[model samples]
Every structure is written in C-alpha cells, then in structure tokens.
Target: METDNKESIIDYQYKALKDGKSIRLLYLHTSSSYHQLPIEVSLCEFPIDACPSFGALSYAWSIDDDPAPSDRELLCDGASIKITKNCEAALKRLRRPKQDQILWVDAVCINQADLEERSLQVRLMRQIYTQASWVALWVGDASTAVDEESGLPLSDLGMDFIHDFAVEIAERTNSGQALNEGPLYQEFIKDRRAFQYSESEVFAPRVRGVWDVFHRNWWKRLWVIQEVALATDPTLLCGLKAETFHNLKIVIKALIRSEQPVDVMEFNSLFIAHTFHQFHVRHMIETGTMGKISPPGIKALDILNATRNTQASDPRDKIYGILGFFGPPATDTENIFPDPDYTKPAAELYADVSRAIILNTKNLDVLSSCYGFFKSTVPDLPSWVASWNDTPVQYFDGKIFNAAGSSTVVYEDCGDKLLMRIKGRHVDSVKLAGQIPDSIGYSNEACIELWRYWWKFASTLDSYPTGETVTDVFKDTLCWGSHLDYSRQQLGENKESFNAWLEILTGTDDTDIAAKRIFNDGEPFKYAHRATSVTWGRNMSITNKGYLAMVPIITKADDKIVIFQGSKLPFIVRTEDGTSKLGGPCYVRGMMDGEFATEEDAGAMDELEWFTLK
Candidate 1:
C-alpha cells in the first residue's frame, strides 16, 4: 500500500484484558498505510497464542527461529491503516494495516472451520473484545468504535430499535390502569404482562401514551412504527395520535458530566436506531401511521413517493441525522455484504443459506480466512463488497419485509457451518464460519440454481410459499423492520410439513426426514409435528411451503381491515402445565388464534421446534 511516513514505529506486545488475561493481536502502528493498494506485514509462521507485556522496547521476534522473516509476514489486500499520533489520541482510532496481516479484520473472519469450532468461537467473540486490554473499535460500534453520522448497518442495529423500543415502552404504559385514565401523564408504570416485566412492578417517569384515546405502548413500540409519523410532525409524536417521545433531554442534560452517560448510551441506542427502523416498518404498513399515505415498495422509485408523504420531523431522518454518532453501521461484526431480495417466491422457499453463517465476529481470524475462500471461489459478488477494495468483515443477513410490515432473518445449522438464508439480489450467498456445505461440494451449479430460486423470489414479492401474501406477512410482522438490503434467512414456515415442501421446491433433498414423517395426509403440507394446519378450497393444502406467496390480503367484505385466518401447522392447545406450544410468532385473542409476522423479525417462536437456526 503506502510507505510508512511516520518516523516512529509502534512495537507492542503482551496486551492484557480487564480480566488480566494475555491476548494476542498484531498491534502494529501501520498509520502510514492509508489507501495504499496492497502491502504486506510479517506474521510469525503460525498464530501467536500469547502477546508480550510491552512491544517496541527492543527486538521481539527471535531472529534464529523466525520463519516469516522481517517484512515477510502477510500482505494486506487493501488500504493503509493509520494509527493515532499519540497513544491517547489513538485510543479510539481503528485502522486495518492490511487484509492478510497476521491479524486483519474481525468482520471477515470465517472462524467456523468445523461445527465444534464454530460453537466454541461465537460465545467468545463477545468476551474477546469486551475483555481486550483496549479494543480498537472502528468508527462504528461493531469492531472499532461506534461512530456518528454514518449509514446504519442492517444486521444488528435494526434489532436494537425493535427490542429497545419494546423494552422502553414495556417499562412504561404496561399497567392495567390503562393509558386512557387521563390526559397523557408524564409518568407511568409497567404492566404485569409486559414482555420483560416481572412480578415486581417496575415504574418510571418521562413516559407518554401512544394516544390520549388508546394509551398503548406508543413510545415503547419499535421506534420505527412511529418514527416516520414523528418525523412528519414531531408535535403529533407526543399526543394520543402518536406516542410519547422520550426526548431524553432531561436524562441527557443530567448526564452532561457523568461517566455513566457513555455507558448509558448503549441502553438508549434503541431510540437512535428506531429513527431508521420505524421508517422501514411503517413504509410497509397499510394503516399509514394514522393519516400518512403508504407507498408500495415495489421498486427503488417508491422512495420518492414515500418521501413526499414522509412526516416532516420523521424519526427516520433523525436517526440518520445522527448517523456518525453510532460509528460505522458495523463494528467487529461483518456489518456489510451482498443482500438477497426477500420479496420473491424462490427465496421464500429455498431460504437464505449463505447468509446464516456470517452473523457475528465469532472468531476474527477464522472468519477472515473463510472470506478468502469466497473471493477465490465465488469470484463474482456485489461490486461494493468485492474483496480487493473493501473493508474486511462487511456482510450480514437479517433484513426481510413482508407486506403487512414484518421483517426477520432465518438461520439454519448445516452440519459444520451455519447457513443464513438471506434475501438478496446479485450474490445469493457467501458461506462462512469455517464450515462449507457438502451440497456446495457437489458442483457450483447446484448452488447457482439454489440461489437462482432465491434471487428471482426476492426480486419480486409474489409467490412466497407461505400461503400468505406480502400483506399478511407485513401485518403480523409490521413491527419487524426490513431495510432495503434484502438480507434474510430461514424462510419456510417453521412447521415440519412446510420444511418438507421447502426441500421439494428447492430441489434439495429432505435431510430432516424424521421430521417429514410426522405430517400425515389431510394435514397442511402433509408433514409432521406441526402445531397448526389449514387448507385452501377443494381439499388442497395451503401449507405447501413451495414459496407461492399468499394472496388477496384485501378482504372481500372490507378493504380497511384484512380478513383473518388460521394455518394447519400444529396445535396451539395448552398442555397440562398450562403453557401453549407453537412454532413461529402468533397473536392470541380470546379464542381467536392466528399465525402472523411480528413487527420485528427476531425469529420469535413459542418453542424450539417452531424455529431453527438451521
């Protein structure tokens, strides 16, 4: 890449974590290598297990035993990394010296070389950096550090919006006292049945009701649900029409001088994230945030119309307005990558396999190695994500939108590796975690056709095998925010019959046959252990999991509300223990039970069998 311009060298060793454990990382001051095309850094012949206490004091490597030799470590694929001029100044800076440096990027590491290996590393990534002597977080929260005014990464941050908004709202307005008790009150209490609430009542002030009329968890709902509305008119955001705006002005002012504020940022990030997530969520809803118009997201052109009716003070803009504050969209995780279109039929069935593998920075070194294989073999990925001129570790799956306003990613464990079936366009998928599919071993053609189904499906929002339409998917999962990236995973209905149908549709054999046998004729999808079941006209089963999208979300009797229905997946009946078992998320009202998408797609399910990482 670029030649070293700084006169000083950053030779360091033996870094220790807060827990006082020795950690190994090639922490060289490659500040001078910014934007340089290609450069090399000498790594010891093998990975170092332990780092030294202090680096650059003197010659560290034993010259007699070194195999890489000086200046012969590993060559970086792109960019020269710049370090801070002073230790304090550099404390927050993140730089990638080279792609192939003994240690390069946490995002691109393909650590799951084996199933056991993957299991061991995922749980450790959270610890490795959290305990690092000093984790050089990039400009974003993923690896280096969270940044300000940066584009939001779709993978992890979006979830923060839904979960945080839910938690925040749940903390407020969850009481049986009902929000309509009076005009919007400044303080509120938790409802015993709230998502995260416990027997002990949790209360807090600074909360407001969704409306003076309903008094729902307006503020507590995913920020995305109301962000667009708020953005249109922040004033409306505070009343019965909208929800409470935890402007956080009071708390922020209080934190002006406290160290706890920085730590507190993590807890409030959901608010920041809802700014964007809310937009994606509402964009798909038919209700249109009260009076706002909804845009049919068929093409990129829809964005223009969406903007026209966009609430003036929309939270989406507010979230993006402070983009740089969260650092980069992704940190240690592979925050950027190719996205499959989730709007189609094939993707509805085949599932997003390649995406599931690269979820987190389980093992930086290992994941990076897997990325190398992708660049070498796949050869053609999206231009922005190409290997040569890119940041290491920049891809993730988990963005899919159903018409009724729902989104989520599906993950499947394919033996040694985790397959994240995603909704994308160009590159269907790229496997990671040191584990490659045996199916991939056969021929790239199988992989190509497999992805072709996904590609065509996501490219268009029709024919999703769900026996439900985009509108149906959106209704149940409206709170789930699906961004433009089309990243998605684990699609077929979670029930066993649909799993079998997915196998037939994808041209992939059913690896889970024992599960297939559970479903009998006269059942939905004619397969097993399903808790719900339904059939269309003429004795035909609607549980085909063939990716044929459900149709006619508009009810014949009315247009304002969709006609509700049920599926044959399994029994929602309660056990003797008084608990109900079901797969996927559902809405239970008195005796009215229906399977639908959640506002946010965090893979909500009533039981382990209902959802599978595999």
Candidate 2:
C-alpha cells in the first residue's frame, strides 16, 4: 500500500497471536539524521519456532505526558503518524545509519488503542524480549563528555564512578581474581587514614554522585526487570555511551563491596544506597549469576516482595511484569501463572495471584507479607492480600536477623474460600501504640545524645522486676540472631554488650575516642544510621497483658500479636466489625521457636479460631 504522491513504505497490520501463530514486530528502517529523523515502521511476523533476529527496546516512558503525538512523526506504512518525543529519540538512537533494524518497540509494534490486542501482546512480552537477538536499554539520550573535575557529567557524575568501578571489576574478573579482591578493597585497607579522616573531603562527594544516578526513575520501573532479565544480550544506553549488562553487574557488585561513608551523607542517600544494594543482590540471584549460592528457584511471591518498590503504570503489571522470570507454565496442575488481562482491577489481580501462589505452593508464607491496613483507596480487596499496587510497607528486615529463617504454612480450603492453616498460640493484645518518634538528627552529637537516652532507658527497664531481664526480653523481641548478634560480638558478653547494642542502634559507636584512634573502626555507621532511621518509623506498643512488641508503624491499639504455628515470627492482627485484618509480621519474645506451642504454655493459650481472611 502507498500514500498518494508519497514514498511507498511497508504497510504493517495488526494480527492477533493464534494458538499456533507468531508475533508481528515493527521493523524500524534506518535513519541518518541527527535531528527530526522520520522513522520508517514496517510489520514483520516473528514465528514462535523460528523468530527473526531483532533488538527490543526497554525504556521508561516520559513523565510529562501520555503517549500523545509530538512534533516529530514516523512514516507508518506510507502514512504519517505522530510519535512521542521519547519514542522519536529512542528510534533515532536505535536505528542504524545504513542498515534496516528489526526492533520490537512496544509503543509502535502493538495496537495499544485496542485493549484486546494490547492484552494479547502483553502476554507475549517475555517472548518478544527473550527471543530478541539483543535488548537495548535506553536511559534517555547519550550523556555528554565526562567532566574534568569529577570525571563525569555533573548531573550524572555517579555514572562515571560506576563505569570506572565496573572497569576495575571486569579487570579483576578477567584476571581470575575474585570480585571481592580489587583495587577498591586494597585502597580501603591500605589508606585507612584517608578514609577515616578525609572521608568527607575525598569520598563523600564522589559517592553521592554515584548514588544520584541509581535513584533515576529507570532503575525503579517494574517492567524493565523482565525486559532486561529475559533478554539474550542486553546493552545499557546512557546518552551516547553503551555498556553491556555484564559490565553493569560488575559495577553493582563493586558498589556492594565498597562501603559508603554514611556519616557524611544524607539519610535518603543512605537508604537509597541500601535499597540499590538489595536490588542488585536480588537481581544477581534471579539472573543466576550469584553461582551456587543462589536459591534453587525463586518464588513468584519473593520476586514481588523484592521488587515491590518498583513502579508500574498499571498496578497489575507489578505481578505480570515478573512472571517471565518464574519460567513458563508447567502442567495443568501447576499452572499458577495469572493470565495477563488489563480488564481486571488491581485488587482482583492481586487476590488472584495470591490465591494461585498459595494453592500451587500450598503454603501460607505469602500471607506472611500481610500487614495492618492503614487506609487503602483500592476497592474490593480482602484484608488478606497486600495492597500490591500501593507503596510497599517498609519492613526493616536488616535490623531483625532471624527474620529470614524458613517457616512452613499450610493452605486449606474452607468451604467456599481459601484459608491459611497454621499452629501456634496467641501472645498478647496491643494496649498502647506509639507513633514513630522524630528522627534522631544525623549529626554525631545528635546520635550520641540519642544513644545516651536509649542507654538510660535500657538501664531503667533492666531495673524492672520481671521473670526475664528487660535486656533479654527486649533483645528477643527484636529477633536477636541477626542485628543483635552483631552487636553482641562488638560489645562483650558483659554489661558492655547492652551499651554496645545501644550504640549500634544510635550510630554512635564509631565516634568513640578509643575506636577512632585505631584502624578497627566500629561497623560502618550506615548500618546503625539505617537502624535508627527505621526505628523512628516503627510503632512501639505495650500489650494489654504487659508484654512489649515493636509492630509496623501502622499498627494501633487492639491489634492482637499471635505466634502462628510454623511462622518464624509473631504477626499482628486487628479485628473490626466481624472482619480480621492482618497487620503484617513482627518479632515477639519466646515466639521465634515453637516454645509457645509447648504443653507448659497450654493454659496461656487464648482461644483458637478458624479466622477467614477475605
């Protein structure tokens, strides 16, 4: 087909994927123009068994507007069609100057206006990217030349550090040295004085710059996870520079090892750094690059939990986006994968996914993610499933060590609905719930003051007459094996250990004179700093029966703390108007093991009920 008095272009038509059919991809013709390039879009069918070679585009859409027409236009089948500036730029950068590039640019390839076609195309997203010869990650336009002072563009100086760091890591990897053995580590050991005294002067600014790049919106997108993870070969595009995913992994690994000087940076930067660290670690595990240490296979719930912070335009994509990583569906009995349908509401989608995971895995561990319902705007969701569409509940697992231990939860069918069946005893009901206190300021003096306050509080609490010492009970309440164990190692087994735990909580231990003069710097202040920051947001509550527990910040008085059978930690639940709401998970004293289920505690058990969480 041709337009009147215009150059003839390949006319692409939309064809749905039939039972034994292939997907049609947009073949973008090459363009040489640097400005206002008119892309030529043609349709090419890629068979399931013999897919044509193509490069897929992975990108975050522009925030200024929807997929509206811009001044630039693309020639689609001899007809002019307006394209977004973002798409225009992506096409210009992706298109080769001399050769035709067969690409699967989702915006152009799928008839997005047609809801049915969009749903069909989304289901095949995994195939589109995985089958492609390469995947180009468009991180906006190319960056300008590296700046002389910081050796990177001022706006993205962190990229330069990351790139340099990645190069060093690649060198070490190629030389057969472990990734942990590198110049960064050597410098860290050899130049302790420089890092200790000149941290702000030398490393603070550089670290901040690198962190800025990671906080970019592209890193937090939900869909890119599947896009990049499923690709055969992925290339990262930043401005004009190009880097492979392998090199990017190296940079991430290097950053994970290079301890950031948290004392000098802002709290948000520290949090972001920690988040990126976890993100990279999870990515490594998921992509099977973490070697034998990786899990046998990741559960869909785990993926959703790990990437819950990742943003998605449609909430349902939060689950749908990561489906590719779980591998294809198995038999009819194992078909837990939720079909991609844009028509479903976010709550319905979340509920269905939760149900499938529970029925297929036959475990209630998925419900372990449930937390108190503060206030949800999403309509028609049971209190059981988390608001997967909303902002993720910030559960500070880093502070509580034993939180990672395995737990067994069985699922049961209760007449018309599903229910989690577990064994355990009720601990206490919340009597007083306190809001998270104001942050202990970031300064050294402020941290020390906070430490002193906590120390005094601990001493006073220890003086109280109780069966178990206040310190022991409090440590157990925090689920000690993780963060508390580290504190115990730092502080001796005596009274000093109690003070050491306080110091760890306040981020003030390293500031001591004795520790400052020696090479043995106390744990990186960031750990304590994060612990303190996270503590500020947690709800401190006293049980009606005089028990103390730290629940999620959203928890309120009347929430019941129950140690469910097989759960590693206790959970908080709130019952109102004949409906029970799960208040997420928590750690309680004497509940880590099955101690609560023992016959000795039989009399302490509150009544057990078949609680149905809708």
Candidate 3:
C-alpha cells in the first residue's frame, strides 16, 4: 500500500548516470482516479538508444517569477519529492487509467541539484526529444467553467474553433483562395458570413476562444521551440482536450501572415510558433523530405532576435536553450559553441556568445541588438554586449543600410576582454531631439499634436539636402521611408499614404470623427502603424549638419553620431571620462546608403578615427 504524507516521506535523490549517452526516464504508475490522487513515478537509467519508448514533455516550469509554491508531492522510487503546481497538473493529465506510461520529463528526469548533471543533460536535450516516440506539449489546465450556450469546456470550445479554422484555411488555400495571397484578415472581417462568424464583431465567443488558446504561457517559453521542432510528432494538451501540433502550426502561421485581430502579446505567440515551424521546415528541407526550395538559413543572430521576448528562469538558458537549432558540432572539440555550462555567470555566457556570433558572422549587425542599455537589468555587462534578458527594444534591420559604405570591420587589438575598439568616422552631433510621445499610434489627438510639433520642427530648416520638398522628407522621416510591410520604398507611396492619413487627422477638430474616418477607411491605420513602429522607442531629431534622422530614445542633445567601418547603420556614442560608451544604433535619413561618403571627401572611408567602447 502507498501513502502520501509529507512528514513520513524522504525526498528522492538522483543517481548519477554513466556517460553522456545515458539518460533517465520516468515510469508513471496508472490508477483509475481523479487528478488529485498522489503521483507515483519511478526513474530508471538507460542508454538513449536502448531506452524504452517514452514521450518527451515540454512545458514551462512557471509562468512568472512568483510561481505558486511547490506543495504537490510525487512519490518516486518509494520516496517522495515536491513538484511545481504546473508539473503536477501536467503529469496528472498525462497519466493513463490503465497500465503504465513512460515519459522523459526534464524536471524529474534531470538532477537539478547537480550543476554538472544539468550541463550534461542539457547537451543531450536535442537527442532526447528527437529519439522519443512523441512529444507531449502541455500548455496548462483549462478553465473548469463550461460555456453557457455550448455546454463545452472553455478550452474545448477554443480548441474546436482552432481545429475548424485550420481546416477552413487549408481548404481555402487548396482551392486557390490562398488566405496569404492578399489581406485575408481584413477581407474576412468584412465578410463574416463567408466564414460563418457572426456579423457583430471580430471577438465572438469562438474567435476569443482561439485567442485564449494562443495566449497560454507554453507558447512564450524559449525551450518549447526546440522541443516541438525536434519531435517526430507532437500533441498539444490543455486539460483533457488534445490537438496535433501540425494543426496548431497552421493557425499560428495564418495569424502571423494576416496580422489580424491579434495584438502585441498574441503576435508574440505567433512569432514563437512561426519560428519553430520554420525550424522544422528547414530540417525537412535539408533531409530532402520536402522537395521544395528553402528560405535563407537561420543564423545565430536571427535566433537571438526572435527569442528576445521569451523568458527563462535562468538567464544563461537564453543562450543555451536555442543551441539545439544549430545541430551537433562535427566533433566535440570543433564545436562552434562550448557545451552549455551552468557554472559560468550569465553575463560571461552572454559575452562569449556575442563574441562567437560576431566571429562567425564576421559582421557587427549583432551590435544593433544592444538596444536596451537605458533599461538593462544585467549586471557587469559590457556596454557593447547585448543583454538578451531584458525587454526587447526597437530592432532596425542593418541589411537596409550601407551607412559605412564598402569598408569592412577592422578589429583592433584591445588588452581588456570587456572593451571593444573600432574605427569610425564622426559624422555629426544631434542638434535637437523631439519629444517621444507615449500615445503616437494609440491616440488620434496625441498623434495629431505630435505630428504638428514635428512639422514645426522640420520647418525651422531653410531647405532640404536631397533636393526634395520639406513635406516629402518630413513624411518619409516619420515612416522611416518604409511601407506598412516594413519594406523600404521611395517617396511616392508612403508620402501619399501619410498625406491621406494627415488630411483626415487635421480635417476635423473632433478627434472622434477624425478617428472614425481613419479607422472606417479601407486598410485604415496603415500610415500610423508604419510611423509609430519606426518612432515607438525612437526620437526624431535634426543633426547639427541639418540631417533629419531617427535615433534611439536614449539619444541626448549632444550625443555624437558616428558611422563605424563595416557597420551598415550609424552608431550613437556618448562620451564620458575621455572614453566612449555606446548609446545605441540609429537611422540618419541621407546617410543610410553611403550618402555620408561624398565626392568632395576623397578616401573618406580610409580616414576613420578609433574609438574604444567601454
């Protein structure tokens, strides 16, 4: 007979494994009882190849820092150990009523108390998931309440809507009505009867059900990307309902492509889902399983940028969690990255990875990722090193600019490991920085006031440099010369869109009427979105040289703008105590495409000054 008493039980201890090839598996005993029953599991060691069939479990340890206390007990190997509320919920749902279930759960299978064992187990994570029979992705328990009309559990209703949405999308795409061919979400919103959605609003019960499903914490964790991508087959579980990962991927990709009713948080979920889907697709393309052309290979920089919003209990996992996407190194010694070492400090690990990415890519695009310096939380981090643990700041694509022209990066030999010395040309100083409004896109009146202020600021200049009207330059600067899709374009299209949008904004004194006109129009809010996206965390400013540009919010009145060798975008550096500290990357309108290198300054690219960044 088994009993569940905390005082009478001893905590389970983890046994050491033989080698890197060895792993532990949990065999959960079955019982015909509710989820409240005590969890009984036994762990056994086996070589990865020789282990019994098992399903890999992917889940978040806790959604937030203040997780519920670990009061639930798990009876393991005739002893007992406490587990998180989330882990207990997942195991209770996973256990079958008959026979036994074998699972490879990270929390239970790996010895968390032993740092060495953790590092070794993390190294085997890729192989463990890939070799498993299937991967069980547990989002969390569903709401216990049933829908009033449908009598279905809230999670079940949501999953039903999601499954049906995927089927409809697949059918439409196959029938030549590809949802991605154009603005499908907008069209869908217009014709609700076509998709069988009610004519009332976008957030009907079923539609909101879909939203709630994507909003789960499982979608936001950094580790699930590798787990789902590596699994041969993965099933998503919420309470008692289940869905194939394939179906869920379909809806997620569709949602991201359409950018429909989903807001920022939901969009992040879509991003995570899209990222792992791309990872799996890339693998299939490489194995020749999918006979189709593949997109550009994913790089370390791309992974870092994509997962910036994701969270990790340990900051070191921010770098270590995604290493599985890079496949095994040819040999242990030749590996581009050292094995995940839990012993190193988070800042040191971040610095090592930052250096490796620069050496591997041979570019400074990664430096742009060092944007959150003003609000960074990482201690002892170099000014140039990116703190991936912070909230993601504005990201400017370096590929769109050639600010430094054709010069390649010239690395200087710096004695200190924390300092990076580079050659750059000091372009200009910020003469005046405009106010960064908190309500640019969200408030119509606020947008109009801010726009009026910026227009007045631009009028202070006598004339423009590029031979264009002040109107065109001001509008282009507002949108960063990019369209709604973030594709860089010439002056005509964005200028027209901004003009039409401004006409409505200024046409009426009543903001409600103006806002309605803007929103009620076809593909409304496009111009405002394009502008706010560029200006959200940035400041519009005029340089001492009369160049109109957008710099990071951290840019001050006297901050110096410099174009570094081999860097596509210009850098803003603040001087203190005779040494320079990086403010962040910026966008100078005329200087983006080698316009800084004029015909008058012969060999200007060769005459770069050295600045040591601390």
Candidate 4:
C-alpha cells in the first residue's frame, strides 16, 4: 500500500501486484493537505528494506525548527515557534509509544548569531552528521520528489519523531570518520559507511538529494558543509552543481549554492594560489575584498586561482618579483589619492598581464593592453564614467585618471571579429599612444619604459587600503611584479612633491574661483577637472601667479592666473604647460590709465619713435 519515498507517496501508488524498482514516493492529494501518518504499524513489525514507516510518511512542514546550538543561540528565534494543528496530528502519529527520544539537529541546538561558534562547527563537519542515529532528509517541494519501490521490503527506524514531515534525527555517539592530515579540512568522504543513509545510483552509499537547508550568509557556507555531509544522488543540493558530474565539487557546489562563500577581502590581495599551476610561479591576483559574487565572478576567480602556480618555487615569488618596481625600500611619502573603502558598493577591476616574453617578463604594452590593464585594475567604477576622457579626475589611489584630448585606444573584439575604438586613461594617452607597438623587436624603449612604469602603477592597486602615497606605490613590498633596471629608471632629482598639488589647485591664496570646465561631447562629464597653473610674471611665473606687469603677482585664490587683454583671457598656461607664449608680455595701460597720447603725429615713425610710447 505504501512506498519508501513517503514525501511523494501521494503522487503514485503501488499496485499491490506489480512494483517499481525505484524508491516509491508518496504524495499528498491536495496542496492544502497537512501532515498525516501512514496507518499504524508496531516497531517490531517495521519492515526494513523499502517499506514506508511513520518517519517516511508525507506531512506538512512545521514552522518550528530544531534547537539552536550554543554558538547560534543568540540567533535563535527565542524558542517559541508556531506549529499548526495539522503538524500536531502528524507528530502524534510518529511519537514513540510512551518513551523518550533524543533529537540532533543544528537548527534547534546551535545559535545562529554566534559567528565564532558557528564557524568552528562548520569547520568540524565530519563528526556532526554521521554520528546521529538516523538523518532525516526533508525534500521541501513534494512535486520535486522521486519514486521507486521495487526491492523486497525491509527498512528501519524506531521513532515517530517526524514533527510534521521533517525528520527528528535521534541523537547518538560521535562516530563520524576523520580525514587525512592536511592543511585544511574538507567534508566527509562520500563513500564512507557512516553516512550511507541513501542508496547511491553510481557509487556506494548516498545521502539524500537535499542534505542541508539554506541560511543566507557568508559564514554559513562552512555550516552548510558541516551539517549535511551526505546526500542522495537523485536530488541536487546547489543550483549550479546539481546537474554536473565533475568531482571538482568544492568550488562548483559552493558556487552552485545561492550565497556568498568566502571572505572577499582575501581576494583583494594579490595571492599565489596556483592550485592548477606550479606552486612556485607568480600567477594569481584577486581584486576587491567585500560583498558577494555572481556566477561570472565566481568562475573567473576559480580560473585565476586554479592557474596561479604553474611555474613553481612558490607562486608568492612572482608577487615579490612584481614588487621590484616601487624602487629601493625607502621612506614613505604622503599619498595624493583617496583610499576607496572596498566594502562599500563599487566595482573592482583586476588584470594579470604578468605574461612572459622571450627574455623579458615585464608587462610593457600598446594602448590596447594598457587600457585592459588599467580597466582591469581599477576597482569596479561605473563603466560609463570609465574609459578615456578630455580631462581626468583623481583616482581614489591617485594615478591620473584623464585621457589625452584627441585619441582613443583601439582593439579587435574577437566576438564580432571587428575592430572597435575605445579611449585610454590620461596617462595612457600620454604614455601608450603609438609608442609600444604590437611587435617585440624591443626598439621602442620609450614606450617600453612607460609600459613598465604603468605596470608599476597598476601593482599599487594591491596596496590602496593603506592609503599609501603614489610616490611610494612602487616602493611597497607588494608593489613589484618583475625585475627592473632601477638605476636607469630613477626619476631624476625632482619629483611631484606634495606641496606642488597644494599650490596647483589653491593658487598662492585660497579665494580664487578661477576654474575651467572640461566637456565631453559638449556636455559636462562626471568628475572632470581642469589643470590650473601657478606662474608668476617675474621669475615667479612658474604656473602659479597673476601677472600685474609692473612687478610680480602671486595668485591668492586660484593657482593659474590669466593675463587678459582687458576683461578677456589673454594667455593661460596649463600645469607643467610646455606651450611657449606666442608674444611678449605687454602693458595696454596708457589709454586705459586715461593718459591719452596726443603728441606723436609723425608719419612712418622710425624705431626710436616707436620707443617713445614704450
């Protein structure tokens, strides 16, 4: 009359004459049907193999769950859970005949709020599930259950501990198997006997299809592994891995689960986790350390970490190699950029151009590669605001974010097999355009040098959290990725000092409202700024002053001052502006000073006569 899969018992029934080989499922007729048990049968008469028992009967799921563990007690629902009369009836149908029974379940005993305790239990999983008397597999949706009831009936269990349809596993000794000594502990060996609660299709013992219920949180991934160590092959656990057969199950299963699994912060650091590569080679770099991952992100990091160490000696060595660019271990300077808190909602861009050439391992490249590296390393800012622009904004970590005025980066998108035009960052426009060609003849040393310089800049993304200054970016221990000839690369005697920025924007004084509006497509672009100068008319004309013509004028408000031809801008130089003034500084003051010259009327005055007005 009944089959083993009581959860689906109502879907298809046995004919008493012919039987199916699979676990026959019992389903309820109406979705409104609450929990109920099969007709009474004594413990002595409990058939062992493939027969339905009170525990296997389909019933309504009770709202009340298992007790919270000590660790999660704080997260417990105060122990008062609502249960419908339907579930009480189901419980009466399964209770032991006037006897006591111990139940083991994480939801009821452990505290969900205690993160530390929960984390430990999650790490120690093998000892949890296998030690129980019997594990109750609750397949939530009745429509998703499978059915099979062919083999001779002889199955077991003593308690009517099914509070509604959910199984109340009886507690027992801790007898789960242990794992081999390793750096990190994994879950139970799927083949072990202790967890042979379900009949596996291809392998030996199997757990139920759905082993653990979901509790959304990054810390819970560990708990999920701990709680349900076994699962029947017929059902799927995570949405991503349920349909696949590959045993590279850890990442896939965790990815399959609908939640964040690991501490994203670890990814922000450039690591050497080359599981698929040689352990000693430089290989991986994870970007950003906050929030969750989607299907795309999970797969990308998996591939990156998997291939990190193919060369060997410790992939970390490669990271050290990358650090070579910041220059000799030196003193710290104030960083000009802002430190972006990765924990907030923003995007992260990571690129690994640590590719090897015939002899050089440096990442020197053309604009295409430069843009790729720049975009990849930039934290996930809005794409619309990314790309090349006329004027640049300061990156949080302060590399120049502007692109050149009239150039774009070009690339071939293999998907369309067509060429595309994209813009470059300001530095890219200045450093990568037409310089580093696609060839490696090594002749374009200028561009090559710039490429290496940019790589040095990119590596600093790894150090952004510390608010380290840009001058010290390449100097940090984590900044270098390859070797360099520092002697030749030593930026000459002078460098962009901290005070230069102070004068650049504020001028000599603080009241100048003088600023230029940078436009893109004739519209104000987000976060754009103009380069202000700080020149003085005398020897002080170094892009920092207002020209008074009589003596020298130091700017008070804006740094760059304009020598206007009476109310209009006459001459303005951009910061570090190399453009020479087309004409000499002149005073148009004689008439403006109201001192009219009515004396010189001689036609074709000679050079001496011209000097008279001067």
Top model number, lDDT: 3
Q: What do the candidate models score in CA lDDT, each in turn? A: 0.25, 0.57, 0.71, 0.22
User: Could you tell which candidate, 1 or 4, scores higher by lDDT?
Assistant: 1
Off by over 4 Å in 4: 1-102, 113-120, 144-614
Arrange candidates by lDDT, descending. 3, 2, 1, 4
Q: For residues 59-80, could you state the per-residue lDDT of candidate 2 as single tens digits? A: 7666332433555567877766
Q: Give the range of the ten consecutive residues with the poorest summed lDDT in model 2.
A: 484-493
Global lDDT for candidate 3?
0.71
Tens-digit lDDT string for candidate 1 (1-614): 44455444343221123232222344333545444422333322212235432121001121112221233222322322332122112221233443222332221121212333322233333233223332221111221212133443321332233234444434444553422232222122122123122321132212211111112122222212322332322211111112222332222222222333222332233223323333443334334432222221111112212232222122222212221111122442222221222232222211222232223311111111122212322223321111221222222211122222222322344442222222211101111111123333322233333323432433354544445554334222211211112233232333354444334434543434322332223232332111111111001012223222211111111111111111111111111232211111111111112233223323533212222122
Evaluated at residue 110, the lDDT of candidate 4 is: 29
lDDT of the structure predicted as candidate 1 = 0.25
In angstroms, give how far residue 520 of model 4 lies from its true place: 40
> Highest TM-score: which candidate?
3
lDDT by residue (tens digit), candidate 4, 1-614: 22244242221111221211112222211211222223221111111243342122222233223322222111111122222333333333333544423333333222334443333333222333333333333312211223244221111100011111121111111233221211111221233233323343322111122222121111111122212222112122121122211222232222223232222211211111211121111112112321233322222223223232222122222222122111122321211111212232222212111111100211111111112112322344222222121112111111111111111112222232111112111110011111222333322222223323333433334333225443343221111111111111121211232123222333432222211212121121111111111011211111111112111122122222222111111111112342211111111111112122122223311111100000
- TM-score for all models, in order of appearance: 0.22, 0.75, 0.87, 0.19
lDDT of 3 by residue, 1-614 (tens): 33455467788977799998899999989977755457889999999889888888998777444555768778897787778889888998888888789999988898888999989888888789889998999988885656779877667877887677778788887887856443434332433333332322345555555555666777767788778777887898888789997887776666655444434323334334524433454355347553322221226666667677777778888888877665666633223566789989887777777766666555577787576347667768877788888765563466776777776665776787677787788889999988775544646556556665677788788877777777777777887666654567677775556777777755645766666566443344667666756666767789998888777876889999988776778888887886788888887678888876422244754667788887
Off by over 4 Å in 3: 1-6, 63-68, 172-202, 256-298, 330-335, 436-444, 504-524, 597-606
Candidate 2 structure lDDT:
0.57
Worst 10 residues of 3 by lDDT: 289-298
